[model samples]
Target: MKRFFMLAFLVGLIVSGFAFKVIMVTDIGGLGDGSFMDGTWAGIVKAAEEYGLEYEVIQSKEQSDYIPNLSKAAEEADVVFAVGFLMSDAFFKVAQQYPATYFVGIDFSFPEEKNLPNVMTFTFKEQEGSFLTGYLAAGMTRTGKVAILGGIPIPPVQRYVIGFEAGVKAYNQIHKTNIKVKSVYANTFTDPKKGKEFGQALISEGYDIIQQACGGTALGLLEAIKEENQKRANIDNLPEFIDDLYKNGGVFMLGGDIEQEWQAPGHILASAIKRVDVASYLGVVKAYTGEWEPGNVELGIKEKGEGISRMPFTKGLVSNKLLAEIVYIQNLVGIGKIKIPSTEEELKAFWLKGIEIPF
Candidate 1:
């Protein structure tokens, strides 16, 4: 009887040790930024609730917090997640230190030189979704001019810009119309003031439609759009371009990351949705199930990794014909019928293909 009790106690200990613990480290934007961090956290929460796994999140307030937070999480958690491209280097260093723990990085493709067997990176084909939004912007614009605001000129942000430009160029070629697109980068993701300044400037320059890849800074841009529209409502005998803007509620804004149509209701035309939550949830599930694969993985529309949102508010606002056209483009890109440019050289080649720039 003594030996039987001792064997049962050892079995209980082994079973308890297999319970999964997950920890996530957010980038500088943190949890409430209503963008990347929020999306990733939602996924972690979902996985924990469904799988009965233990989970925690560390919000990084600055770049310096990355390494320490990752190291701390690595020490305790069965699996640690680094939630943005900014955390790539820090994750790499800490992951090497904890070879026994599984590490996953979102929005990061582990470099060839630093590939670790215990580390896995997930990246999204953001350009494909951005291309769809750009096409929508070109078709929806009454002013023949649209603009894109970027938080930083990083590779991920640049992918959106390049795909957007290509979509606009494709629209011009097909319709034989002169539609102009302007892109500007604010160089920071957390500054709403700069976002508002850039937004107001674009509106003043006669851009009636705007797309943003500026993360939290996009909130300020949305605020500017609301305030500007209210001011324009009181004006008398507005110009043709001004009349167009007034009729459409000042300006239409396109969002990036998660669906942001509810953020400003009528002002938000649509959002280029990157499903970071899905990727994060899958990573935790794989690690918990002992099915974790350590390598670089890229997900696109075909894999249901990225997409564009068509909210209820946009239903009657955007014509069925236009929506159908956008869907057609989306399907083409998803099935490899159309290749969206993600690099500068590819963008240049795509634009020069039988399409002449009028501006």
Candidate 2:
């Protein structure tokens, strides 16, 4: 009996020694919304496969779940990732308690963390991508007006909006063109009905294109567009104008945070994608390897970490001249040819002064 006990103990020790455990805590949005959470999970899986590490994920039911899920993961795993900006407060609290365990906060910024070496924060300049997409929308609109539909007027969403406006203003200044935008926030992250209503209102106002930064709410906006398209079935070149006030007035949809090109093949011009997978995976790898540093890592078009992706569906739809112009604008932002605004104050200041990047 003594000999058998000793052998069992040895086996357990060896197994524990080799186990490289990691845990991921996702936001209330869940894993597979074809959005941010899914992108983060993709990176987690990649790291697990590449580094021979084991990972477990806890899906958050709401904001309240952030602390508990993170605490639970910290108890067992080598490192934990608190995904989403919504999890920032919870992550800070949990990290303070478990000073030894590593934490990575995606889109969560903390300049002062009580010197918590275990917590690392990551953010991206989504405005950069948003600006590029906004420029595209301006150039594509046959009419001088475009509309933006957003999930919520949160900081992140606001960043995209500010960037979009700045981009449009800069493009006009550069090319000496006349283009303007009408922006609205749906104010809810997942309300489809409101989204459709907002889209309808924009169409009624003679807006020719829309940039959708909303999540599930964007689905309704797209549905509204589809319904409008159906009514113009027999029309030539898809009716330049339709009688229905809710109909898409030659509107094009641009999505953010996910590649929504397939959601509407020809209608969705492009997508502004946040590479959450890469961010999450890097966090895991850092924690496991003992190189995890606590600080903010900001990504943008310059970093190739986030940007607007040209869709396969519209590969040939946008004219070559238009495509070249869009690319030029993107490259300008990427290489500092055009300095886009990041904050509300900066955006206001830039436009007020009519300042243009000399690039």
Which candidate number maximizes TM-score? 1
The sequence of per-residue lDDT tens digits that candidate 2 reaches over residues 64-101 is: 88888999999998889888777888888899899888
> What is the lDDT for 263 in model 2?
70
Off by over 4 Å in 1: 1-18, 233-249, 351-359
lDDT of 1 by residue, 27-99 (tens): 8977776777788889988988899989999989999999999999999899999987888989999999999
lDDT of each model, Cα atoms only?
A: 0.83, 0.77
User: What is the TM-score of each predicted model, taking all chains together?
Assistant: 0.89, 0.85
Estimate the TM-score for candidate 1. 0.89
Cα lDDT for residue 47, model 1? 89
lDDT of 2: 0.77
